[model samples]
Target chain A: MTRRLSLFNLTSLIFGFAFLYLPILLLVVYSFNASRLVTVWGGFSTQWYGALFRNEALMEAAWVTLRIALLSATLATVLGTLAALALTRYGRFFGRTLFTGMVYAPMVMPEVITGLSLLLFFVAIGLDRGFWTIALAHTTLTMCFVTVVVQSRLMTFDRSLEEAAMDLGAPPLRTFFAVTLPLIAPSIVAGFLLAFTLSLDDLVIASFNTGPGATTLPIKIYSQVRLGLSPEVNAASAILIGIVTLGVVVATLLTKRSAARARRDGH
Target chain B: MAERSLTRKLTASLVPALPYLWLGVFFLVPFLIVLKISLSDPAVAQPPYKPVFDWSDIAGFFSQLDLDNFETLVGDDLYLSATLSSIRIATISTILLLLVGFPVAYAMARAPERHRPLLVALVILPFWTSFLIRIYAWIAILKPEGLLNQGLMALGAISEPLTILNTEWAVYIGIVYAYLPFMVLPLYAALEKMDDTLLEAALDLGSPPWRSFWTITVPLAMPGIIAGSLLCFIPAVGEFVIPDLLGGSETLMIGRQLWSEFFSNRDWPLASAVAILLLIILVVPIVIYRDVEARRLETES
Candidate 1:
């Protein structure tokens, strides 16, 4: 099985990557197409890119989406890191089962259910559905994802560094900030990036919890898409894909560098 | 020293408490509210549901709540059919994902160690992209004048464009496309960890490759298979965006129905009932996932 690629293996890899990649590649290529028709190519042009910038409402939604992503990702990172610490560090506590369930449930729960339930909760509590509500919803949903990422890092985390720092008389908080945080910082950043992209990508939760004046980029693009295919949406999606790709690349490089550093230092 | 110990204890307990409180309020409490709303009657007022749970008149609030929404769900065949259809669609899509995902995962697992990471990253890169955009990409490809049809036509494979968009076939393709990563990642993780010697041992005993693969590789990969299938199947059951965007208006998935119930029809109580039922249906699989995760963590730790 580990030998040279058989026909089955070669075909699978070729078709798999093509299937995974071709659609998005086509979408990106079509963004620069001169034709208004989404699929057909008259020639290469960046008209849609120009139109994307000129579209005021879409721009506003994009701005809103970015701010929400930033705020919620930062918040989710902190909370999720704490939750990871709780799960990994704390041995056993009251309601541990329930705590674990709550953290994991949101990760796999249906968006519609999560969205609908949150909207209901907001209504029941008399909280207005708007920017803050959407942020809260995104935080709740994305924090679990953050927890999963950070928890994996924490599980494999070396404890001797913190212990050595403690043995040298550093306080717990100081040790965490000075030692543990630096070592796990890469994962924290990774978790933040994950949360950020997820928040940016979410449409369902935002849709349910949204109110007047809180349209996100996905919502804007969705409304336009429903009307018909347009090069404008292709341009917008291309830009979004570009941002996420850049973030992922940066995070991957950071993690790789840190891993290499750890290997060097370990020996 | 005593004061320091007290502060340390306070923070020690406090760390777990913060996230506990956050999830308890936002995650657990909201679910309770959904359950309560589902049992209540729908109204035309603000919030669109009745029996708002007046704390002072708790008795009255409890009395007002009934199984009306659940009754509605039972009496009407739409909800039942939608739920059944969603299950059917999710089941088939999970199988298709396995069919498409297994070979790629196996190939990736068998790839050179240095190249495996890059392959994994490529698989995950698209997953990190927007779900809506991915489905939107399919809309362009599957449409009559879209890429697939045009490519086929140009190749002289067909004289006329095939209509695949806005059909169940499109939904299947979209699910397989989107969830391939979910399926592959876990399977790769399992398969990659497998010991090569066991398969070799089987073959050394004169068993054929296919026989050894079925008996050795498949059983060893059971955990991954289960994990991957549950990962894809559970969420696929309650999927909203894929069905709404890719499937036609006639698509009867519960997620789409719930969206319409809550958004277009404004039947908040009924939507709550739908959500409750969906949660109930998925409870078994979710619990299984949690059990598997707990065991995995236990073993890892």
Candidate 2:
């Protein structure tokens, strides 16, 4: 019976993995196809990748996306770390629950609502919809992710270490820089990377706020897909997938190494 | 010295309140604007700005509200049906995600400790890519002359190519593909923390393995199940991408309808009304998540 159950489990694993990844694998394969038809198997070529480079609008949109992601992710990390520090350290204060809820609300709220509400707010404030608006919206949304990551890290942290630094007559700011920051550095980096990816991949919020000239890569690809599918978009997607995968792997390796070092140093 | 200590305490208390002020100005205020906009009449094109405090506009606002937008919503068979369709699609997709994600999460949980990281990475790999790219890939697979149909045709499985793209099935596939990792991660977390002793206890009691899983494993994993369901369902309901990409012109989900009402029709009031209604539906799950988290916190404390 146990053997049968193990067999069933393996089958389930294969089927599940295949179901999740097959479509993506097919997409990557067809990016190199010589024929326009996705399945024709007319010899592989790098024509699509070449075509992707030649597309001016796609390149421009990619530049816009990179700028927005960098700006928003940086701002979100700083603000979110502060908020997380405040929430985790100072418990049971007035409106503490409300503060946490507001911070988290943006993450769960539908992008449509977030986008629409922000758009309306911009109009009300007489701020024109454009790249700045997009950045602001992205910052608000990504901050929640940063907060969650940082908060989880803060939860497991020892508070006595900071108190020890204070007992040594160190100023609070100096103690934070000399002690707390180093301890939570991994979580901060992870939060930043997560925010960066979210900002880069965002489409719905960007769509609602972006002006004609401020089109991001996702919006550019969306408009193109709406008109028709092209292998150039496929090539672009494949390239993005490659870059992101490399970045995540590096981040994970760094985190694991730091953790291992921490464990060793403890001994 | 005492004054300095009091000042430090005051600063510490004020520090947390600062983030809430930022949230209030940006997040909460925008939602308030949406609520105000929904109250105004769309008949008046480019309506003048009425201060939220104006008593005269308040009466006019609520009096004119007349449920016209909502009545129009319910009266329009198309909108009503589309809302129901959105719910149904989201429900089915959430169930599909759980079915596919559960065993994969189980494998990740049960794997030798050294191999678990790689398995977890695999589950999150697709998530790192752009959501649009993954959904766009599905178009390549499901289009009539797409890969799936072409392969089946070549294999003599069908006489002619099957039309899979631009259908409801395609939407389901896209949703399940997009959200599977969300289900997997939480379930993995839950299953990883699960006590092996419970299953051992059940086995010692002469329960079969399958029966033990159904009775012992699933109940303990209910929190993860609920979390994953909400994670999948909430976003799926307001999903603009999958239905737009896969469902074609015939599929009129609420998100698309809301988009059209705002962008295509330029009916901001009506669109805001639709958005507000969607927010109302979402509140149930939002509240549930809050209550669950609060309960967990209390229990831990």
Candidate 3:
């Protein structure tokens, strides 16, 4: 009750971290293994890393994935910020329930369903199933996450600043830009990174919506994996993990810095 | 001044309208398209799906809309069982996740204030990485000569490598492992905000630690448990990568079934129908979550 470090609590903390991190650490280590056998250790080597580069299809998919992620994450952040504002700021509006449902439905809906439904939408509208369509699909899939993240920050936000700005004769839009946006910017950034990761890590939705030459990294890895496990995949996964871990570090740092700054600002 | 006020009002209305229209066309409309496609017949045409409505003749359009795909769902044991089995697997996975996640979350909540952030960050870091990559890591760990089996054999736990790779157990492990972050985050958020004084009072009343835990901790953490459970369970039901990569051919999940129906079998209509059914099944939890969120926001505002 006094919050001393109990043995059971320490055990839980350590084991939980181990369970979460071990498989990943093992994968990273074995990516350098020279063994053709996945589980065996034939000593450390960078040979698989070399092989990963030599694979053209996988590289192309990676390129496609990066582009889609960049475009979609940016678009989703902007739209999600707007949607978050709509949910938080607009007290009531026409079709608010329907709007709210649409925003949240995709979050829980299975990838297969969202992918299938969107693919059909694309077909009906005569939009080609390629990079553009995948980008759009990713945007729709991710904006909900962005909205949830930003809206949480927005909900607890003090409206007095905005009101005070208006009281000082600033227009509503200008006040939003000059005051409110800066306050919630960190969460918006967190939302962007989240959307980017979701887009990059996507397999099922992109698989459904992808056409020839638009294969994403996950789709490429999945196809190869279905064929069989190889060291190249391990290498690819290691690189992916490294990049994303870097991104998450940046996001966490940003969130912490802003939160600290906000505390100072509050004080 | 009146004209400026009108402009400000228009901007206010327009900002919200942007997301509304986007979701309408992209999100909601696609659902309608899926519904229509589900009622149509599969074809060898470019789109591979016949239009449910033949607009050339209104009567023909109505007639073309058939229950054949929906009927196939009822008639086929595979689809029915796939849905049921997916629900069962997801439920069990949620329970396991809660068991593993609750302790970690509680510990994090009870951790020294200086160490809490780092601990929470460690839990979330894995989630930022590619899900496919995480699942791929298991193949190395679960294979016959893989790390887990080899480690067990080395410890004299068993003379042979356990057959865990490409099994339902592996899927369960993968789900819990992957979703552990989702489960822990919400739980931590709840437990961290808990009043330690409540526990102290319970203990002072001569209740044992475990007894106080049941009365104070568990009850207080109920919101977190339910929230974490739904967050993990809902998505796990529709999981594709885990069941596909980890579970063998014998594993029958709706996600896998839907994949094969669309990609392998070339049955777009049925795939759409399968997706529709999954959506319907998930509607209950989604609606409840939406209402809870709105109500929470209402109170916050």
Candidate 4:
């Protein structure tokens, strides 16, 4: 019986890993293929990568995407951290449940609904639908993620450190910056990266909010795929995969190192 | 001490009040706009920007809310079938993910502690890639002269290439492929925390292996299963990219329907109505989850 269970587990492990990795592996391989047809395995060439660089519109979209991601991620992290701190530090108050629910609603709400509502809201407010609108929508969604990550970290935090700083006559703001912020720094960093990745990968919200001139990379990729994909897209996708994988690894390592340092500090 | 007390009072009063104001302005305001628009009449070329509070407009609004949009939805057999098809596709995909994810999660849970991180990384690596690109790659695999068919033909399994692309099967494959990790991670978290001794105890009580698994393991993992199912099902219902990219022209889902209603028909009222219905469907599960979580917290406390 144990042997059968082990065999079942082994099969699932192998199939599951292969299922996840194979398509990505194929995509990476085909990015270097000289042939335009994705199935044909021609000799390796970096020509598509060069083509991707020379595509001016794609470059512009990529730049806009990066700008939006960075700005929105920073804003979302700040607001989310404040929200999380407020929720965790204070006991229940009037409208606390409603506020918590509102904060989380965007996280699980269908992106289509969120995008449509925000689009309508922009139209109603007489705001031109453009990059700033897209950033606002992204921040709304990304802040929820940041709140979740930061809130989890806050839950594990010991409260005495803040009290000690106050007992030593440090101001509340100074105590926050010096003691509390340093303790939750890893979570803050994690939340920022998560927000950045989410903003970068967003297509639905950006699609609804964007004007003609404010195309994001995911929107560009979506339109390109719809118009029938080219190998240049494969090359572009390969670059994105590499950049994100590297970012995740580096962030993970940084957080681990910071956690180790925090343990050593014994505070 | 006086200054400290003053500071604490100030912080207590000011800090918690701020987030509520922020959420009210941004989050709740937009949602309220959606609800207002959903109730507004379509005859008005552009509905009023601010919600109309006049008693006559309010009465007319409620009176005109005669399910015109919903009647249009139900009158069309296509939309009805599409919703059902979407639910079926989502359910199947979720089940497949569970079947495939369970073993991998179990292996990870049972693996040497040192190797656990590596396994978890493998599970998450695909998630970091572009979702569109991942779905697009399936086209290469499922196309008529594609890799899968070609490989199968070469192996003498069949003479004719199978028609796999642009079908319900393709949609299922795409969804399961995309969401399998979501299922695995939560299940792994649950399984890893499980006490193996419970299983051993069941075995020592003369229970068979399957019996022990059903009695001990499955119940212990119910939270993970419920969470994973909700994660997979909700997105699958609203999924636009997968069905669009993989299922092609034949796949009629609510998401694609909503897109067409907005972009093609330009019927904002109908689109808003559809969005409201979708939101209604989602709210039930979300409320249930919150209730369950709150109950669990209360019990734990």
Candidate 5:
């Protein structure tokens, strides 16, 4: 029975990973195709990569997307960390339920609703729907994800170390910065990365909030895709996949090293 | 001493106050604006909708607010059918995600302890990739002259290419592909945390393996099942990119309807009403998720 079950489990993993990965691998492979016809492979070539670089619009959009992601992610991490701190530490504040609702609602709210509503709100307030508007919208949308990530880490945190600091005459604020912050830094970093990726990945919300000058990479890719498939677009997609993979890998390695160092310090 | 302490107190209060104010303005206010826009009449003017409220006459503003857009939603079959189809697609896709996601999550949970983290990371890697890129990858595979057809033809499985692209079937594949991670992650969390000894003990007793799994594993994984379902179902219902990129013109999901109404038709009021109704359908699930999260957090803390 155990043998059969192991076989069953292995089969499930094989099929699932294939389904998950094969499409993406195919996309990356097609990016290297030399033919103008995207479905046909003439030979392996770097022409699309060169074409992608010369596509001024795509490059500009990528720059704008990176800026927006960076700004919004920083803003979200700060606010979300505060919110997480409030949820975990500030027991029974006024309007806690409403605050919690505000935090949680955005995570599951349909992007269209969020997008439309944010657009309406901006118009009503007479805010110009430009780069700043996209940044603010992304910050609001992504903060909840950060809060969830950081809050989980905050829950698992050892409070005795914090208590020990306070017992040794450290002020509450000082102790938090000196002890709590360092311990939870890994989660905050994780939250920031998640928020950054979400900002970069957004289309619908950015679509609604965007104006003439604020075209994001996702918005750009989407319009090109609607026109039809191309190797250049495939190359662009492959590059994005590469960047995200590299970022996640680097982050994992950094976190692992820090954790090991902390473990050694404890011993 | 008093002045110093007062300054410290104010600084202490700043932590929660800042986030609270940010969410109130950017999150809560936008939703209120959506509600207001949903009630107003459509217009050809700038900002698209006439102001229903006048600062001078608040009571008159209340009277001016009418259900014209909502009435149009009820009167027009387009809005009704779009909403129904959206729900239908979301419901079906959610079930498909569960079917595909559960076995994979179970396998990951039952894997060797050292390999579990790597498995979870593998599942999440694709999620980090651009959502547009993932959907675009399928267009290459599903188009009439796409790879799927070529492969099938080469194998002599069919003489002609299957017309899968720009159809509801393509939309299903896109949705199931895009949201698979959302379904699997929570289920993995639940299943991994489960006590395997219980299953072992059940098998050691009179119960068979399958029966023990049905009784012990399935019941314990119920919470994850609900979480994964809500996570996938809610967003899948309002999915715009998948349906637009993959589905035929006849797809008629509410997200696309909302997009067209707002963008193509420039009927902001009607679009707002569509958004409002979508919110209503989603509210129950959103609240349930919040409840689950709150309980989970409470127990953890």
Candidate 6:
């Protein structure tokens, strides 16, 4: 019975993985096609990659996206870490429920609502809907994710260490920076990465918040694809996939090494 | 010296309150702005909406608040149909995600311990890729002359290409592909941590494998199931990009309507009203999720 179960499990994994990967594989393959038509492969060629390089609009969008992602991710990590610390450490406080609602609402809220609401808020506040607006909007959206990720890390943490630090005459702030921060650094990094990717990939929220000068990669791609199929989009997507795959691999290696070092430190 | 100690305690709490204040200003403030906009009259002017409130005439301001947008929302069949279709799409997508995600998550959970991390990584790697690009990939596959049709033709499975792109089916495919990772990860977390002994004992008692799965595994994974369902459903319901990109005009999801209302027609007040209505619809589930999570954490400690 167990043997049959293992076989069943293996078959499920294969089919699931195939479904997950086949579309991506086809996209990557078509990016190399010589023809302007994505379907007909006129033998493998790098012409789309060359075309992608010369696409000034796409490059500019990519640059803007990177800046927005970096700025928002840093802000999100700091705020998220604080929120996580508050919820986990401060216990039941006044308005904790409201604060918790604020954190989780953005996670499940439709991007359209968030984007529209933020746009109106910026307009109401007399703030220009430009690069700064996008950053602020992304930070607000991604911080909730950070709080959730880091809060889980904070929960699993050894409270005894913080107590030890305090008992040894460290200030509460000092304990957080000196001990608690280091222990939760992995989660913070994870949160930051998640936020960065989210900000970079955002279309709807950024669309609502962004103005004339702040086109993002996803927004640019959306408009381009709306007009017609573009091989350049496939090329851009391939590059994005390659970068993310590499980052995931590197992150895994880093996580493995850190976990090993942690195990040694525990011993 | 005593006052100095009081100052330190004040600082301790203030540090944590910074994020709370930031969210209060940016996130909560925005929702309030949406509420305010929804109460105003749509206009043709730049930054179009009218009847700005004056503190001096607070009572007059309250009286000037318009329910026109919300009333029009109720009167218009477009808004009603868009909302219904969005919910329908989201519900069906959630069910499909559960069906596909559960097996993959179950398999990963039961994988050899040494390979579990790698298996989880495989599941998550696609999620890390740009969501837009993943959806873009589907356009290539599902379009009329796309790979899917070519393959079907090669197999002699169809006499001609099936028109999937610009259809609701395409939107479903896009949502399922993009959000699959969100559904699987939580389920995996739940399934992996579950005690295997219960299943082993059930089998030892001669219970059929399928029966043990339903009676033992499904009930225990309920929390993860709910979490995954909410995560996928809420976002999918309001999804603009997928339905706009992959679906036809027939796919009148609220998100796309909200976009056209705001951007194309530039009907800011009406769009704000639609968003406020959508939020009102979604809040019950969000609150329930929050309570479930809060109770779970309380019990964990």
Better of 1 and 3 by TM-score: 1
Worst 10 residues of 3 chain A by lDDT: A1-10
**What clash pairs does model 5 have?**
none
Q: lDDT per residue, candidate 6, B1-301, as tens digits?
A: 8997998989878856899999998888888888988998887788888755677998987887879999999999999999999999999999999999999999988887878888888988998888878888888789899889999999999979999999989998999889999899989878877998999999999999999999999998998899889888888888998998899777899989889998888998899899988888888877787777777677666
Which stretch of 10 consecutive residues in model 6 chain A shows the poorest summed lDDT? A1-10
Question: What are the models' TM-scores?
Answer: 0.98, 0.93, 0.96, 0.93, 0.98, 0.97
User: In model 3, where do residues sit more than 4 Å from their true spots?
Assistant: A265-267, B1-3, B52-56, B298-301
Q: Model 4: residues >4 Å from true position, as ranges? A: A1-7, B1-14, B43-66, B293-301
Return the TM-score for candidate 1, rounded to 2 decimals.
Answer: 0.98
lDDT of 3 at B170: 93
For each candidate, report what fraction of the true interface contacts it reproduces.
0.79, 0.56, 0.88, 0.53, 0.78, 0.75
Residue A212 of model 4 has an lDDT of: 73
**Considering TM-score, which of the candidate structures 1 and 6 is the better prediction for this target?**
1
Docking class of 4: medium
i-RMS for every candidate: 1.6, 3.1, 1.6, 3.3, 2.3, 2.1
Tens digits of per-residue lDDT for model 3, A1-267: 345779999999889999999999999999999999888899999999998899898888889999999999999999999999999888888998898888988998889999998998998988889999999999998999999999999988888999999999898899999999998988898899899999999999999999888989998898888887789999999988888788788777777887798798872
lDDT ranking from best candidate downward: 5, 1, 3, 6, 2, 4
Please tell me what DockQ candidate 6 reaches.
0.67
Which candidate would rank higher by TM-score, 2 or 4? 2
DockQ of each: 0.74, 0.53, 0.76, 0.53, 0.67, 0.67
Model 5 Cα lDDT, one tens digit per residue, A11-73: 999999999999999999999999988888789998999999999999999999999999999
Location of the lowest summed lDDT over 10 successive residues in candidate 4 chain B: B44-53
lDDT of 3 by residue, B110-194 (tens): 8989888899889888988888899988988987888998899899999978999788999999999999999999899889989
- Per-residue lDDT of A63-164 in model 2, one digit per residue for the tens? 999999999999989888889988787767777777878987787788888988888888888788889999999988888889888988888888898999
| CA lDDT of every candidate | 0.91, 0.84, 0.90, 0.83, 0.92, 0.89
**Candidate 6: global Cα-lDDT?**
0.89
Better of 1 and 2 by lDDT: 1
In angstroms, how far off is A99's CA in candidate 2? 1.4
Candidate with better TM-score, 2 vs 3: 3
Which candidate gets the maximum lDDT versus the true structure?
5
State the lDDT at A214 in candidate 3: 95
Candidate 5 lDDT over residue span B149-211, tens digit each: 999999999998999999999999999999999999989988988998898899789899889
